[model samples]
Target chain A: MKNIPGDLKFLSSHEWARVESDGTITIGISDHAQDLLGDIVFVELPEVGQTLDAETDAAIVESVKAASDVYSPLSGEVMEVNSLLEDQPEIINTSPYEDGWFYKLTPSDLSELDNLLSPEDYSDVCED
Target chain B: MNKTPLYDAHIKLGAKMVNFSNWEMPISYSSLIEEHNAVRNAVGVFDVSHMSIFDFDGGDQVAFFEKIFANDVKKISKGNKAIYGALLNEKGGILDDLIIYNANDKFRLVSNCSTRNQNRQWFEKHAVEFGVKVIERSDMGILAIQGPEAMSKILAIKEIHAEANNLQSFGCMFDDDRLYAKTGYTGEDGLELIVPNMAINDLWDQALEVGCVPIGLGARDTLRLEAGLNLYGNDMTINNHPYESNLGWTIDMSDESRQFIGKDALLSIDQSKSQKIVGVILRDRGILRSGYEITHEQGKGEVLSGSFSPTLQSSIGLARVDQGYQENGKVFIRNKALNIEFVSPRFIRKVKMQP
Candidate 1:
């Protein structure tokens, strides 16, 4: 079974959002998502200060087999992006939940977090 | 979907199974890079049983092959040897690329699984007129052991070591119904063993016990791409001829007396004006993939097969471009034109891991 951290909220597309103490939302792909896209070789992250709408394409993750789009779970402004992934994209495969976070966002609407899936719900989604 | 004889073994090893040409085959066991590196630096085994095999016999066998196959079978007919070539239509378009093996009285042909039905139909349509009997051997399984240490690992197997000891490259040794050929698709020294379906599990187990890593189709694609080999469906198809597909060397035009199926059309076409396949290496950060548009000095073309080359630590691809296009070019990926370097279609030859 894949790990679905209780502290995080998820989109059905498999992006995880964690609300930071300062009202910022941290986003990354779920462990199940990384497992499906094996051996990620390239990661194209969104630029800082960019505005993103809810459920829009925010990033791209490429494996040897194919490329996939990483969707944004909520409308937000990109505050920070993962620079380490520019050189070491395989880190997403190794530390997807921790050091492999894609970006941090300052949310336009905090109420959108409630619309996301809970840990138990996300686990059920992964099972299916 | 169909399953190979080693399907249970692949499942037991936690392989990621995928559908490939109506067959449920393993796409990756652990990871694509690991499996690809294993084949480049060490020994790896592949369950290539999905490929189709056919046998030819009868008095008209030699004459029939001379009329159909692009390569000269008579050159390898005496000894137990093999030759790679293509089956073409009357317009010189490739029907399929295959390897033909001369096993003394009978000849063997190995072809892609995707074109199995079509190839059978084409063969049957012409076989009756030539008095040749074409028989499909669906009861057989093929295993390929490849890498720098492939020969040593295979020699450790006791069953047919003696027969395989003196086998040369492109040579074969038959022990009863089993065929051991010193040939492989990967650019490495290895053996392709054809055995009965019932005995495949035993052979696979022995190979695993002897330190051969089980490779899946994901790594198989990367390995073949790094070697600059062509995939049947991706690189060549019925609309392509030998010259455009970088397979001109496989055709034998020396024997004008032999009126092969595609000889007349091939002779009529001018080689200098045809588009050709070439290798391209990305100088940018992103990966190259198929269907990407390319703009060159002479003309425009598209990528045929592209992937992240694990061996080269860079992205490489095969692109079909106009004849005058050479050296450096630009490939458009997502509306951004990135610089690329063009080289010979083959990327590696007889590559071994450096100690």
Candidate 2:
């Protein structure tokens, strides 16, 4: 299993986001989330440019077993989506963090990142 | 939690374990969708040692089975076989679905894992008068190699005549020591092999050497759903009769001369209630899960089994809807609407079936 980068933030629901150098954020479900979901087959993301609040359903991750919503780590507007997931959704199972990146967003307020969990805090939250 | 003999093997492969039928089995290895699509596109093997197998020996075996079974197993020739026969209760409702293999010295019976003990109790209670010995072959291991290349992969390891008649659909035979049947719950071409428990690992190794991915229950459900096969407890139960479950053909009542258990209860009971089993292809952006309610403008029903069909690229499920609601066609998955299509129980596709 890949370790979450220290710089990224996590949600208790298992979504992770990295504040990119450009201030746009890279977002996806965490490795723990993908493992729990089994194999993802489809994905539904908020439209690009659609702003969302923290803790709101930003996207939907569908697996053969169940469908779970990916809550926004920080309030933002979806800027870009990784469309390759449309056909090969299983990439999320193999590499939930890197190649499996779901969407990119520009935070409405970068300060909202404080509400997210750091890698250490995220690991602690999942330990139970 | 219970564990099958393959438990250690699953753990060795880094499989994720989950509870199923009280037994902890691998829910996935690398990916459920990949494993599922592998079975659909090529070949995959599953350690189904969890299923129960029994051997019934005696001259009275056929007679006893005939009385308890709804299928006309007596009509099956020595080399032929019977599949999807209902072991019925007195009320004609399904006790369980079983397969009777016509063996040389005895008839081999395979029943559902969860219902095995209950079915055994029923069989024993009823078999005493018939003088048939119902021997539970619990020591044996059951493995299923399912997909397009399944049979050829197995045949290459050993020799199979593969005669058109012998390998015919639903036909089964014992090949030397192992019993290979062109039968499976998945709609794919495959064989369910029953061998001594000690030799399971070796067989699994051979199957793996031939490039069959080891699949788990997570993929198993998806593959079965893609094929549109009904799961036992989810699709039907003691409360739900066979007719309303869309399994009418499984009951062989054609020969009035044939007397099977539950015939009287079935014949006497009223099917006038508002229920019919149907299929739903989930159209919305969510996975339709089992036990989720299916709604229609006419009425509502419950999803018996639901999964994302790897082949169809959509969610598929079986449900029992009210007769009035079922007739109008469209079914609802959550708030999203899906078209309900009328269909027969899925058939075993040639490439995915083994005889």
Candidate 3:
């Protein structure tokens, strides 16, 4: 079974969002998503200040086999992007949940995280 | 989907499987880079049983093959030698790329699995006049043991070591029905063993016991790309000819007297108009993929196959560009023109394994 952090919420599409105490939310692909996309070589992160709608493409991760778009789980304005991924995209494969976080977003509404799947709900979705 | 004889073994070893040409095959086991490095630095095994094999025999077998394949069969009449060439249509467009092996009285052929049905129909249609019998041998499986220490692993098995060790590159030796050939798709010294279906699983187990880790199609593609090998469907299709696909050397044009299936059209086409296959390395921090536009000073082309080469630790690719492409070029990915360095179509040679 894949690791599903209890503190974070997930989208059915596999993005996970963790709300920071400062009201900003950190967004990254789930471990299940990174496992499916083996050996990520390139990542196209969204620019800071870019506005994104919920459940829309926010970034792209390219592996040798195929390229996949990372969806935004909540409507938000990008505050910070992961600049380390520019030279070392394989970090996503190593530490997908932590250091590999895609972007920091100031969510339009903090309650939007409630609409996403819980840890138990996301685990069931992965099994299906 | 069809499964190889070792499908269960792959599953047991935690391989990630995918559907390839209607066959459920392993695309990777541990990781693409690890498997690729294992083959380059040590030895690795690949299950290539999904490839289609055909056996042809008869008094007119040689004559039939000479007329069908672009490469000359007369050169391989001595037996136990394999020749790689293209099977083309009447218009000189590639139908498929195949390897033909002369096994004394009978000739053995292995071609792409995706084109199995079409290739069979093409062969049978042409075999009528020559009175040749084409038999599809799906009952056998193929395993490739490759890398620098590939022979060391095989030689450890005393039962077949003597014969396997003596075989020259592109040469084959048979022990009863099993054919072991010193040929491989990877740019390394190794063996491709063709064995009966029932015996394949046992052989795979033996190979694993001797420390040959299983590799998947993911690493297989990257390795072949780094080696500068051509993939049939991706690199060349029914719309491509040998001259443009960096396969002109395989065509037999020395003797116009010996007519082959696509010789006339191959000769009639203007070679000057065809784009040449060249290798390119990305100088920028981006990935180059197939169907990407490549623009040079003279004209534009398309990338046939591209990948992040594990050995070189950079993005590399093969592109078909106009004849005017020189040693320096650029490819347009995501509307950004990135500078590229041109190298030989072949990227890697056999890596020297440290003793």
Q: What DockQ does each prediction reach against the true complex?
A: 0.93, 0.55, 0.80
Worst 10 residues of 2 chain B by lDDT: B346-355
Best by TM-score: 1
Give per-residue CA lDDT, model 1, range A1-128, as digits (tens).
56667789999898999988998999999888888999999999999999998889999999999999999988999999999999999999998888999999999988888889998998889889
Q: lDDT per residue, candidate 3, B1-355, as tens digits?
A: 9999999999999999999989999999988889999999999999999999998767598889889999988777888778888998889999999988776455889999999999999999999899998889999999999998999998875555477887777887677778888888778888989889998888888888888989999999999898888999999999999999999989987767888988989888788888989998999977889999888878888899998899998999999898787777888877878899878878996632110
How many angstroms is residue B74 displaced in model 1 relative to the true structure, after the best TM-score fit?
A: 1.3
User: What does candidate 1's lDDT look like per residue over B237-291, in tens digits?
Assistant: 9999999998898899787798889999899888999888999999998989999
Best by DockQ: 1
Give model 1 RMSD, 1 decimal.
Answer: 2.4
lDDT of each: 0.89, 0.77, 0.88
The lDDT, on a scale of 0 to 1, for candidate 2 is: 0.77
Give the winner by lDDT: 2 or 3: 3
Worst 10 residues of 2 chain A by lDDT: A1-10
Model 2 Cα lDDT, one tens digit per residue, B126-229: 88888877889878888898888887787765433454124656767775656777788678887788888887888787888888899998888877766666
Q: Per-residue CA lDDT of candidate 3, range A1-128, in tens? A: 46677888999988999998998989998888888899999999999999999888999888877788899988989999999998889898999889999999999877777789998999889889
lDDT of 2 by residue, A1-128 (tens): 35777777888889998988998999898988887887687787778889889888888888888878888888878899988887788889888889999999888898888888888888988888
Give, for candidate 1 chain B, the lowest lDDT window spanning 10 residues: B346-355
TM-score, one value per model? 0.97, 0.85, 0.96
Error of 2 at B131 (Å): 1.9
Cα displacement (angstroms), candidate 3, residue A91, comes to 2.0
